[model samples]
Target: MSFALSTTVDLDFDRTVAALREALSTQGFGILTEVDLSGTLKTKLDVDVPRQLLLGACNPAYAYRALQAEERVGLLLPCSLTVRAGADGRTLVDAMDPALMVELTGTSALTEVAAEVRSALRAALDALETR
Candidate 1:
């Protein structure tokens, strides 16, 4: 299965990032971390690239449940979401598929938690459609 739920929006990069954050929040997620991929690459490797951001999104309730199911699940604690500029000047968003956690951990116990997370992530992505 594909590992990500992705969508493209017509907004500019910064606006798309803001919209993504808002959409996630509406679905009970919060941005735990943000990594500017473009800036990082430029600063660390001296290479220029299109604007890109990585957002670590977490829904605490789901996180707690996942942790309870598997102690090592922290390895996948926060779901990753990305907002990047496309070559055509549009914005692209991609969110990790939570179901992957179940496959990676080899545990059926995480099925419910993963389903919930997947639903929330899907909702967040759907919200972007209105933008």
Candidate 2:
């Protein structure tokens, strides 16, 4: 199974990133953290790489539901969304599939929450495609 849901955008990297954030917000997700992979690689290993960012996204209600279902689920809280420049010059956005939570936790209770999160993530990707 695909671990992520992804889409490619023809917009410039920065603009694509901004649009993704806005799209996620429209689906009730907030970016809790951002990691610049290029900067980190350059600083830590002196390696050059394409522009890449990892966004930690969270929907508060869904997070709370997951937490109540499994206390340790916080370890997987904040679904990961990545924005990176493709070799073809387009930007690629990838969101972690929330279904992984169900696979990892083996909790039937988390199924509904994961489905809701997946729907929101898929909507964000769908919006990006139309734009």
Candidate 3:
């Protein structure tokens, strides 16, 4: 609960996704994977969900630091961000809070790395607000 950094934007889903990609890039993150959650669910389970996309974002330097701190941390490798359509017709963006790594691993060594990643993610979300 309360595990993400989120914002709602005025743009529609597709536009929001595009803007988010650029925003994340500005924060030194690259998309390592993308998933169209809505589409996949509709196809796989015949269930309909609101338009949703998941982006696996990664910043190499931060990731490396995390890896050095915890050998198994790569299991959580590549941060996740989601773009989804809200009922009000606005698009919502959410990024997984990096602090979760420290919580889950119970390691102080990852604290700094998590903070750096969190800041970058916050900056990226702020960038979306300006667009």
Model 3: residue 124 alpha-carbon error in angstroms: 0.2
Q: For this target, which candidate reaches the highest lDDT against the unseen true structure?
A: 3
For 77-126, candidate 3 gives per-residue lDDT tens digits of: 89999999999999999999999999999989999999999999999999
Candidate 1 per-residue lDDT over residues 1-131, each given as its tens digit: 99999999889998888888899999899989999999999999999999999999999999999999998999987999989999998999999999999999998999999999999998888888888
Give candidate 3's whole-model lDDT.
Answer: 0.94
The TM-score, computed over Cα atoms with residue i paired to residue i, of candidate 1 is 0.98
TM-score of each: 0.98, 0.97, 0.97
User: How should the candidates be ordered by lDDT, best one leading?
Assistant: 3, 2, 1
Q: How close is candidate 3 to the true structure, as a TM-score?
A: 0.97
The segments of candidate 3 whose C-alpha lies over 4 angstroms from its true place after superposition are: none
What's the C-alpha lDDT at position 30 in model 3? 96
* Model 2 per-residue lDDT tens digits across residues 10-95: 88789899899999999999999999999999999999999999999999999999999988899888999999999998999999
Clashing pairs in 3: none
Pairs that clash in candidate 2? none
